[model samples]
Target: MESERYIRQTILKDFGLKSQKKLTKARVLVIGVGGLGIPVLQYLNAMGVGTIGLIDNDVVSLNNLHRQVLFSEKDINKTKISVAIKKLKKQNSTSKLIGYKLYLSKKNALSIIEKYDLIVDASDNFPTRYLVNDACVILGKPFVYGALHSFEGYVSVFNHKDGPTYRCLFPNPPKSEEIPNCNEQGVLGVIPGIIGNIQALEVVKVIAGIGSPLSGELLIFNGLEQEYHKFKINSLSKNKKIEELKDTYELECSFDNSSISSDAFKELLNSSTEIQLVDVRTTEEYNDYHLKQATHLPLKSIYLNHNSLDFEKTIYFICQSGVRSLEALRFLKKEQPEATLISINGGLNEFRNYDAKH
Candidate 1:
C-alpha cells in the first residue's frame, strides 16, 4: 500500500518500507519560504513527511516568481508562509502543515524549534543563518543548510550528532559589500531548485537513517559547469555550545536590504525637497528603462566621476535593484561625510511597478 506513495524511493534498498515509516513519523521545520524553501517543502510533503512547519516574514514579489516555483503571479504581495501553506495543503491534505508569518528571532527561535524534530535554513542573510545554527545547536536539533550565489550553491547538514556549526566553518561573516545577493548578481531559476532538492534529500536521510548523510560534509554545485564537489567540513575546529539565544541578531551582524520597494523610494521622493537621483546600474539595464529624472552613473565609473556630482544636493541612489545603490550611497557618504544620501528602495523594479499602476 505504502509502495504506491513512494514507489521510486521504496525501490531503492537503502530506503524501503522501513525508511518510509520513519519519514511518515518525522516532523520538520523550514525557515525562510523563499527560493530554496519552495522545492524543499514540496518534496518533503510529497514524500509523506507527517508534519511540516514553514516560517517566513516576507511576501511574494514579481521578481521572486522567476525562481520561487511554488508561487504564481496571483501570489504577489501575499505572505509567503500563508501562500505556501495553502498550496502544500492542496498537494497533500493528509500532512499536518503549519505556517508562521513572523520573522525568526532569538526570543521565539527555541520555542518555534522545540516542536520540530529537524530544521532547514533557507534564509539568505548571514545573521539569520547564524541565529538558526545557534538555536539548532542549543535545542539539539539537526538542520539542513543551503545558500546560493550567482550560479553556485552550497548545501550542508549541521549539528547532527554533534557536528560542526556554520561558525566553525567560517568564524567571521564576509563584509556585506564583498558578497552580492541575487538581487544584484542574479541567479538562475534552476540553481536553487537543485540545491533545495539536495537539502530535502539530506533531511530524508537523517530522518530515515538510510543512506549516508551530509553531516560533517559540504557539497558545492556549480550550475555553469554542471559539476558537483564534496568536501569534508573541518569538524575538529571547535564545537561551540550555544547556551543562550539573543533577541537581536541583526544588530550584532550585517544584513543586506538593497532590494527596497519602489513605494518606499516614492515616499522618500515625496518627502525630500532637494534630492538628486543617481542610477548606478549598467548602461543596458538603464537603457532598457529607468525612473524619470534619474542620472545614469555606472558603478565601475562611480569613483572617477563622483567628483563631478554636486555634493551640495541630497543624493537618492538607485540601480536595477537596490544592491548597487547601497554601495553607491556608502561611497558618497564616506567621500562627503556631511552630504545627505538615501538609497531608493527596490530600485527601478519598484519604481516601474508604481509608475505602471498610477
Candidate 2:
C-alpha cells in the first residue's frame, strides 16, 4: 500500500522503482518553513522522500499567512514546527517527519546538519545561508539553495560532489541594507512555489541520480516579467577553500570593522566636534529622525558614491542600530582602507535616548 502511493513518479522509465527506493531511504533536511520552504516541504512529502527533517524556530505570525501556506490565521503565535508537521503527516503518513522548533546557529549547525544525507537551504538570511553552506561543505552533502526578493527568486544546488558552494556563487554578503528583508520588500506568493518546487526537483534529481541536477548552474525567475534564466556557476575552477566554517558575520563573510560608544558619538555630534557624520539609513529614515549634521548616503548607494566622502577626515557612521553602520563601515574600509571609519555603538536609537537623559 505504501509503495503504491509513489507509483506515478516511479512510472517513468528513467525514474523507476530504483529511484523511488532511493528516495524512500534518503534522509533530507530542510532549514526553513517560510514561503520557499512551504512548497519544498509539500512536494517533497508528496514525492515520498523518506526521513524528512525540518528545522525552523519561528512561530506562525499574521504576516506569514500572506506567503507561508503551511499555517493559517488560527495558528498565529503557534510554533511553525507543530503546525507544519501535523499538516505534512496528514498529507503523507509514509514519510517520516521530525521538526526542530529552534533556529540554526553556529553552535548547533554542524551537529544537526551532519545527520542528513542532503540539505535544502530555504533559510531567509545571508548569515544562515553561509552557515548551512559551510556545514554542508564540511559534511560533504549537497544542498539546494532558494532565495526570494520582491517578484524575483532564484534556486541553485551548492556543495554537491565538491562542486561550487554558496560562497563560490556569492563570495560576500551584500551590504546589509542593500538587500531588503521580506518585510521591507514584498514577494508574490507564487514566486516561492516556483523556486521551492525547482529546489524540490533538484533534490529529487540528486537523490534519484536520474537527470542533470543543476550542480553548477543557477536558475532565476522573475514573476513580474514572467521570465526564467539559467546561468553557469564556475566556482569549482576557482577552488576557493571551504575547509572549515569561519565566523559567518566576520570579515571572512565580508563585513567586519570597529564600533564607537554612544557617549563618544554624542560628543562628535556636538557643534564643537569636527568629525564628518555619515548616515547609512534611508532618506525616509533621515526624514523621520536623523542628526542634522549627518550626511545621507544609504547603504545601497554607498558603493557608487563612497568616493565622494573626504577619506582624509575622521568620519563617524550611524544607522537605526549599530549593525548596518558596521556593514557600511566595512564596505567603506574595503574601498578606502586608509579611511578612519567607525560606527556609532548603539546607532541612532541609542544616540536619541542619550538626548532624553541630557
Candidate 3:
C-alpha cells in the first residue's frame, strides 16, 4: 500500500492508519456501471479499497453520456464493464478491478456476489434491486442501496449484520405502473452523483467499523428543493429467512406476454397502416429519433393522455429500451383491460440494430 497516497484520510484522528488498513482489506462489488455506480467506484477505488468488482451488460450510448460521466463520446457502444474497468485501472493501479460483462440473473448472482465482502445496489430497475437484496440476505452479506427518480434519490444500507433488509421497507414490489423508473421519468444529471457519494461514505464506514451506517434508516435527497429526509426502516424476520434464490425475480407485467420482437414489430409496421404505434420515451428522445409512423406520447404523461389512444386498434408501445414500454403496457392494461396493447421488445435499440442490418 502507498501510504503517502492516502495520507490525508489516514491522518484523521477517528480514521487513523487502522481504518486505512481496513479499507485496504475490503472487497466490494457494485452491480451497475451507470450513473450511481461510476461515483461509487471512483471514490472507493481512490480511497484504497483493495478489490472492486462490477457487473453490467449494458453499453455506453449517446443518452448515457449525460449521467454516466466516466464514459465519453468515443466510448459509445463499448461494453460498460470493460470501459469502466479500463478507466478505473488507470485511476488506481494498486487496486484490483474485476469486471463481469453480464447481467445479474439468478443463475450468476449467487456465485459472483459470494466472492465480494460488500455489494452495492447501483442498478436502476426494481428486478435487479430485488435480486441483489435476496441474494445478499441469503449469503449474509451487507449491501448499500441507491436509486434515482426524477430529481430525487434514495440511499440505504440493507442486510448488514442482521439489520433491516430492503424487503423490510418494501415488503413487496409495487406494480409496474405504480412506479416508473428514471428512464420513464427523466432524472437530473447530478442526482446520482450526490446519492452515489453518500453510498461510498457508508461503504467506508461499514468496512472501517467507524460511524453509523444507514442500515435501518433510508436517506432521501431532493435535488430540486435541496432537502434531505431520513425514515427509519424496521427489520422483518421473514425477509431474513431467504435461504436460496427465487426461481425467477422478473416483475409481473402484461408486457411479458404481450411483447413482440423488433423484427416482428417492424414487419407489422410495414404490413398495416392501421397499427397504432406509440413512442413512450421522453419528448427529447422522440424528437431525436423515432419511427415516422409512431406517435409521441411520453411515458410520464401517459396516464393523463391515455384516453386519447384508440382502443379500436391494437396499440404498440416503444421506448429507448423495452423497460418504459413495459411500464406503458402495464398502465394501459389497467386503464383499458379489454384493449389489445403490445410492447416492442428490446425497443428502439434493437429496432435500430435491425434497421442498420437491413
TM-score of each: 0.70, 0.73, 0.72
Give per-candidate clash totals: 2, 0, 0
Winner by TM-score between candidate 3 and candidate 2: 2
Please write out the lDDT profile of model 3 over residues 1-358, one tens digit for every residue. Answer: 4999999999999999999999888899999999999999999998999999998999999998898889999999999988899899999999999999998987799999999999999998877888999999999999999999888999999999978999999876665667888888997788899999999999999999998999999999999999999999999899999998753455232235467767656766665677788999898888777888888899999978877899887888988889999899998899889988888888899876443211
| Deviating ranges (above 4 Å) for candidate 1 | 1-3, 236-238, 255-358
Worst 10 residues of 3 by lDDT: 247-256
Regions more than 4 Å wrong, model 2: 237-240, 248-344, 347-358
Query: What's the true lDDT of residue 295 in model 2?
Result: 82
Can you tell me which runs of candidate 3 are displaced by over 4 Å? 253-358
- lDDT of candidates 1 onward, in order: 0.82, 0.82, 0.87
lDDT of 2 by residue, 10-96 (tens): 788999999999999999999999998999999999998999999999899998887888789999999999999999999998899
Clashing pairs in 3: none
Tens digit per residue, CA lDDT, model 1, 1-358 = 5568688988888788888888889999999898899999999999999999999999999999989999999999999988999999999888899899897876578899989999999988877888898898888899999999999999999988867778778765664676788788899998999999999999998999977788888889999999999988776534556687642355334334323345544755565545577789898877777766677799888977687578786666888667888888787677888886767656676665554211
Between prediction 2 and prediction 3, the one with superior lDDT is 3
